[model samples]
Target: MTEVAKPGVLPARPHFSSGPCAKPPGYDPAKLATDVLGRSHRSKLGKARLQYSIDLMRELLNLPDTHRIGIVPGSDTGAFEMAMWTMLGARPVTTLAWESFGEGWVTDAAKQLKLDPTVIKADYGQLPDLTTVDWSNDVLFTWNGTTSGVRVPNGDWIPADREGLSFADSTSAVFAYDLPWDKIDVATFSWQKVLGGEGGHGVLILGPRAVERLETYTPAWPLPKVFRLVSKGKLAEGVFKGETINTPSMLAVEDAIFALEWGKSIGGAAGLQARSDANAAALNRIVEARSWLGHLAIDEASRSKTSVCLTVEGADEALIKKIASLLEAEHAAYDIAGYRDAPAGLRIWCGATVDVADIEALGPWLDWAYASAKVAA
Candidate 1:
């Protein structure tokens, strides 16, 4: 490990890449390995660590007894696909796509499942009208659009007692915001987002309604071993326990446990929310002060506190990319560019791993980048 030193400089501000963010301040890689990685996941010690992880997650989220949490395959994407493949055929599907990842899932539903999907799309900065949705149909949506930095305000509009299931991809919103669980049947998130854990694994949570859907309705297509939610119409017990369906990266598990423990130490969800809130508030102040910078999300309430997307006034794609390139080269920021397929601008991940002080540092860098871009153009 290399040490960073400068006479007047504070410690390196946390890197704010959208995913796989910089580890928290004072993260000890060696300690995490020793504390979480010595045993096979199947051994008694492994099981105890896994159980502790689950219990801590439940306590942090205040989950109900009826809900079940599982460490599943792949990242959040894997957990989401499993739910879509297993529990989706009961009713007509209503999918929402406001950003890249949401659109990716919609594509999977169209191509992989070959299901006729009714996709509701919004431009990069906007959200689809919830009033326009049909509550009678099963719904799939990203509660927080990670790429676009927009989020659904609340689940309040999701008809209280709808007939169909609600599958939400809450990867970026889980710890940083209040998720009204009653409105969702299945929710998925990866530890890498807010938790700053290792990647390649996903946490899948199922509400009682989703479990019933799994038991009552099997898809017309054959299920693969990894995606299978049930054996003989009963949900797998190992899923909720430490027993994963396949071999998992024990190191990644340890990293997740470490992040979760850190979350608990900082006051759990409330602390995480404060971190995000402070970062967002700091960035919003910057955005408001600048004439050229404006948020991507149109509605104030729906704007995400985790990933804060900003756009330059009348800037073209090439200019936006140029500015992003400058920031990366300077090491003032990284992964702050907008998604390639979306309208171009700056995108900042303001999750819990990111510090308010780091975001404050970013404001001047952004102003400098914007001015340089305008001059070059």
Candidate 2:
């Protein structure tokens, strides 16, 4: 295949951004406008689509009846902040910082809320030692670190029964990995990651315990209308029923509905999991075949199946940049460079939207890029 030079143009397959990932194979944008556009979100049609999305997600994830899912404002970060600001302060909070996203939550607790927090910190590619923590405390963690491509192996490490709640930011982990709902109290995700939908909408799932906390304990800081989960000291029942706390983007909601429905049509969560697993396996094969490139994730078990982060072994920054530019100029990839804050390398989004065949095609290009790199180096 000829490599062409065009900024922002993606490979025929379009499989790379970490979030707002490539849309599902064969997605028809026109169908969205005809079916979802020109309709009021509060109308029966919109409500049905919204309600169906919630039901499908619950069924696919096997969520318990005791749990409630809400389509909320902002993306995963916004959903997480709503949970943190609304549910913390009544208890001692423990924040785990292993990657950039984890550090963000710690900052929210320390600087924004000014809550006295016990933070556990680990360098990139490592997990915070959970064994050292006190279990009788509310805890927060990011299940997958998109920037570092490191993930928590299991919720098995969390105490079986803690007096306080466990909150998770599963933006990059959902659908690609197993999340132990039993071990989590409040979990947040965005539509754009694994689902490959439009952004601006966040999903928040709260366990019964989380709801109890919301009703029984209000934060010391006043809540804004956008962040309000509890209205006048009462848990917002309507939010869980497709009634958003604020004006929501019906277009985004409709996109989420289509994505959720698409997820169901392809064998639901299992299909999404398999797609991610296959993409990751294909990348692993590439790493094994090529000596110059390898995963930045130290351990195979800890590596993310969704966002595959790889470092060009023994290559300098300039060489890595050259290879990345080569890939981009060819329109073979988009946003494949490693995150700015992380060490230089390539980060491939292997979420459900990415096909294994595309990864296979891209594998040789990695080798070609490296050969070009050796000449440049």
Candidate 3:
């Protein structure tokens, strides 16, 4: 292949890391509310901001009143772990692993918790058969596979009359998709994901069933202070109402509130989903136009609209690194490298925060990087 000249025009914003992803376009850190800074998280104003953030999330998610939403520590991982530790001992466990995050949960269930969960696994770009899930077992799965760019198509597979609770690790799935809340008893996400807010905090949404499990069932293993959700055998209702188990970063909460307010200004969840879909569509156009590029997830139905991974034809690890480095050095892209655990390729964030123009501009830079890198190799 011949050398392709470096693209002169760059993306207006090249901030596409899959996690701690691109911030909302036109985001000004200076614009974030500073009143909450240095205030005690337990103070009246601090609690109000937290509750307001939760309320905005519920509104955006269209969450039912039967469900409860709370802010937790440790990002999405913490929220999900808190759910698992509190709820899994009441029934059998089933874990579906399709990507790195899913695999981590499987490890937690099998090794850390010693539950010997029924493990159903699939490789990158594929999903385990939803038809095989047993409803009697407490089931856990990632609603979107962040590392592999695969997502569950819909909630049709979950039985409405299932006996066990359904837990969804929805860090990348929320906002980008219309989540069926009735099908999910427990769900977790971090503001840093779709909302592009600061990290170190997670949101946990619990249906009535999950709350019941927490109030009735106790894990055989000792519960960490951060993971405890019950007080005196009753659900710690305060936690759900903005009393977090630990002190939270008021700055992070303020940033999240800003992102949530931004989301509201742009037409709520539907608008956010549309933005992500458009960005994904734009990237897909780039992939479709080039023979050298294709999606890691072959099936369109299960592909992720938020984090979209691309397979480079005949590219090895070194080649993938070269493409990412070249684009970064040229200020055409940043953090566009595929996950370390995923196959060699590029993983571009197509979440709501990214602009479609950036994705469209990215195609030319990718072309230059790939063509030049191939020549260099």
Worst ten in a row by lDDT for model 1:
1-10
**Which runs in model 2 stand beyond 4 Å of their true positions?**
1-12, 33-36, 315-317
Clashes of 3: 0
- Model 1 ranges off by over 4 Å: 1-11, 33-38
Sort the predicted structures by lDDT, highest score first.
3, 1, 2
lDDT of 2 by residue, 1-377 (tens): 23422333234684688977988887777657447567776778777777877887798787889899998888898899999988999888899987788999999999999887999998776776778878788999899999889888888888777898899999998888868888889999998999898888889999999999999987888888888988777789888888777767777776766777788889988988998998899888888887767788888777889877888777566776888787776767677878777777888999988888788878766766667666666
| Candidate with maximal TM-score | 3
Per-residue alpha-carbon lDDT of model 1 for 1-377, expressed as tens digits? 12222123231663777888767656788868554466688988888777878888887777888889998898999999999989887789989999999999899888888888899999888999888888788999999999999999998889888988899999999988978888888999998888888889988999999999888887999888889879888988888987888878888877887888888889988998899899899999989998889999979898999888888898889888888887776777887888787778888888888888878877777777777777777
Candidate 3, which segments miss by more than 4 Å at Cα?
none
The ten-residue window of minimal lDDT in model 3 covers: 1-10
lDDT of 3 by residue, 63-110 (tens): 989999999999999999999988997999999999999999999999
Q: Clashes in each model (backbone N, CA, C under 3 Å)?
A: 0, 0, 0
TM-score of structure candidate 3? 0.99
Model 1 pairs in collision: none
Question: Per-model C-alpha lDDT, please?
Answer: 0.84, 0.83, 0.93
